[model samples]
Target: MAARTQATRLPATDLVRMGAIEKLTTRQDFETWSFLVTSMLGQFDLEDLIDSTIPRPAEDHPHHDRWSRLSKKVRCWLTLQIDSSIVRELRDESSTGWSIAYADETYEVIRRIIVGHAHTKAKSTWKSAIFMKREDYGSVEQYVTAFRQHVKAANLLKTPISPFCASLLLLEQLEKELPGWTGSIEAGFRSDIAETMTENEFHEICCAAIDEGNNDNADRSKPTSDKPRSSDPNGNTSSNLSSSSNGQTHIQKHRMAPPKGKSARQYVAEWRAHEPQRTPEGNYNYNIVR
Candidate 1:
């Protein structure tokens, strides 16, 4: 047999750099270019690289062509990463003589703009992801897993889901598939207390309920008795005897009544006689003080 060889993979930074170069050369749309460039720069830590490569000079020089050339190259790269409109604006704004200082400021401004835009887009995506409803036929686990993927993609790892919100969503999903199970789970979870639970805790609660429901269903589907039973002396079979006993117990429970107590009228009269009278000033007068 021939030995198999694994293909070599490129480093993440190299891949990002390649992508950035491709976008710079081919993508004409500003938004696409901006997004790709910003993502690549972040992945490769290009800002830090540029900063370290061009340190500030202690004294200002009348002729600093070397620093000016490096700054120009950096600016050119940034311009290529954006739209033509932005390029025109940058050229118009580049009235100041080029220097290392000017380059640093320009890079910082561009970085901030891209980072801000990225954050806004991310926030929107996260909001939409979390608010997504469960699909008609999708399982709770599948829906939750998809929501988690969305959270991860939106870079919301640190964002904590409110327990109240988590529980509400879980209950909504559960109610659809396991009607009365929600009530059983809710009986254990006091609204105020459950509201304090995290999303993970609520998810565990949902899983437990699902397992319990499955077990209950399995138990109900099981055969009650496989063996034949002997008839009683009265001609009742064992099954009939068991059913009668159950019916008698149920009857006794329904037939039971409340213990004898004072009559409602007498009780009300007694209560009235002992009740404190309210004065004109809204104070209770136990002794009926004038």
Candidate 2:
């Protein structure tokens, strides 16, 4: 029994307190998490899995089983420390044809990720984004998501302000975007657990507002239909299509203007509304003066 116990026991150096690390929520959180996580891997004698000092063997190789096990252990330690949204972003990078080869990447893949983010720079840009709203992005959803990202980037910053101050800042930003929002919303945004940005609570709170904004946008874009029908100079009824060489109108497969109610004014409004370069601020942006 004593011999079996001795055989099963790991060396003192091989054991590490897993609780020593925290989840990596932002670039600010990366440095500390990376150092501690690397130390933990080293303590377990698995540093080689992430360091690129050793090459991996093919699956059929004799030593492949050991390498695969160690690589998985290292990968688990790395990923389990990241925020789930961040995890999804990392996994989604593969679709963008980035450096990572697969969504479920090995520790060496994690190592590459770390190498990309471990650069030493700090900026206050995220501070400005804390107040970010609809000035930039086209949709309410895009604007909302950008605001969430800015807050997330600010998450792990060492306090120039207290956590109490941080919550107040978040509240102020929320109030700017949503004038009447208060009570439980203020409470949730103020709470660290509720608006972590990785969590769905904040998003769920604003879903109604988002849908309403989009629906309002849709309604405004719809053309008015009560006008009397007017034929083109060529006597063609299809206003959305082009005049054929023989003075007949041909239906254009690619033209998107309304068949029934489109007028010159409506077409211009739609054009400016959909223009990517034009910065729109809701329905007010549709009107153009000569």
Candidate 3:
């Protein structure tokens, strides 16, 4: 047996223990539509193959026989990539919405790992002329002899990694370390982009909202205000969307004149009820409002 060295074997375990080995588990949990999976994964299983027998997408569509055009494996991989990237971006601390800081630090670590060394790896190796030392290997030598392969066999080194595979691995890395990070990440990611804007920008947003002639979204766009008090000189301001700083309504407030006739039971009830019916001890009990 070729003797294993401390340098190679130790780093391999560091990767495997980190759950990087699960990156290759591409067997999807759900059975996807045949034509779709083949178009995405570049390969397909027997079930997928059988389903594509029926013709799909009208012939006039640019990709009329898309099912036939793409291999099953390609289709599967593409789909996986989209899902995984979305998961990773949303789960990180810097993501918008739910501004509460994460209770765990894994997202911080993962973000650093991806944005720093991994991004520079290719250039770092190539600029140093390391590939010249391994000239017997193929042109894509950086991946052909990657460090993680000794611990786990992954096709990450393959040319044009299926977006799905890249996405899947990215998601898998986050999932392994962060555990419950997906829900928070997804919440942050899928939310409206406005969530990420600064407070001053949020003020400008309110001006934009008033310009839109809709207060329904004013809170999100404008500076938050303290709850208006009923007894204040403003005399019960209109809905924030319609209310002006002077407490005047942009639209006329139609005050109904007192009913011309009936000092009837309804009117009597309102007049008498103006002061809530109080208890024997003189405290108001809200149950009487009914």
Candidate 4:
């Protein structure tokens, strides 16, 4: 990742359009700004922004009490970062005798905007940053340095973060906690949280299933000499049961049926002639012969 450039001064007109810049210089005039910032977070509407920030009596809503409490924290954080008085007013209003209608609305809106925008930006930034880090997986220091560079790069791009930083910090903490398990920094950052079973472990499960299947087949193949036969009306003769190599008890008297239709080799050849085999379900699919 490339180094991030310094922040530049944005035009006043653009700031005003985004509601980041306000004409209000006094405490009373800052109400409009509070409302606008709240709306961006999806907490309040344009009308509410003006009324609550201005402390206009008629414009207040009953529901804003809850919002007021929540919006204060976010507004304060935003204010500190933005260097705007209106932002400060919103932050200050968060709990200071503010109506619930104003607080809840502002809190929700600002939180939403921060969360939603930060997530969107973080996804793009993390992907690019992590990919580059992966390419230089041999050195952990280099990976972290690159990651930080990417973050600075993202900030330079005017991306919202306050929300994203925590997740990244947690990832950093994980590295600190397990310093010995180091390999690739990018791999650490980019790997999915859900741990997958190793291939050998998975194959053992399959092998166990196969063994069970063979055992079931052997049991089914056992001859049933105990079955009543017409030849022994009095049932004077009893069949001898012996264990077979397949772990199945079978009667010695049971005879094997002769191969039908064609010889084993010939039958196999004929079966192979059919390019694709049709399963019992009548679906044509490829199969491998052992």
Once fitted onto the true fold, the runs of candidate 4 whose alpha carbons sit more than 4 angstroms away are 1-81, 85-123, 134-139, 148-290
lDDT of each: 0.49, 0.51, 0.32, 0.41
By TM-score: ranked, best first: 2, 1, 4, 3
lDDT of 4 at 109: 39
lDDT of 1: 0.49
lDDT comparison, 1 vs 3, better candidate: 1
lDDT of 1 by residue, 1-290 (tens): 42211101112322233243433222124345545654655454444324433454333442244445444555556656655654554455455442324445665544333333355666776686567776642455666556545544444323445555656665676676666777777777766674466656765775775575566557779988765533322444433223354455221121212224756576557657785555455644331101
Off by over 4 Å in 3: 1-62, 65-86, 90-121, 128-290
| Best candidate according to TM-score | 2
Give the runs in model 1 whose Cα sits over 4 Å from its true position: 1-117, 120-129, 147-160, 209-290
Please write out the lDDT profile of model 3 over residues 1-290, one tens digit for every residue: 53322111111111111101122112231123223433432222212322223333344544324433332323233324333653454355346442312111222222222333253543553333222222333322232224122111122111222323332333343343234443443454334443453434333322432343233335358887775422212334333236678987675343322354745576657756787555444544332110
Question: Residues 1-290, candidate 2, lDDT per residue (tens digit)?
Answer: 32221112233343344454787776556657767876876576555555543445555665555555545545656677777876787687656665443112444344345434322312464455545646567876676566655654544332133334444454554455555553445565434552344334544544654665577678789998763433332444333357878999876553234434678787767776785432232222222221
Distance from true position, residue 79, model 4, in Å? 4.6
lDDT of 4 by residue, 1-290 (tens): 42211111111121122234444344233346455554654332222332233442222444343334334443443444343544555556556754324333544434333333356666786556544533344333444445555644454335633323423442443354333332243255434423443434323323433354355557679997654322222334434556889999976664322244557686567657867545454644332211
Error of 2 at 76 (Å): 9.9
lDDT of 4 at 197: 30
Alpha-carbon shift of residue 106 in model 3 (angstroms): 24
What is candidate 3's TM-score against the reference? 0.16
Candidate 3 weakest ten by summed lDDT: 12-21
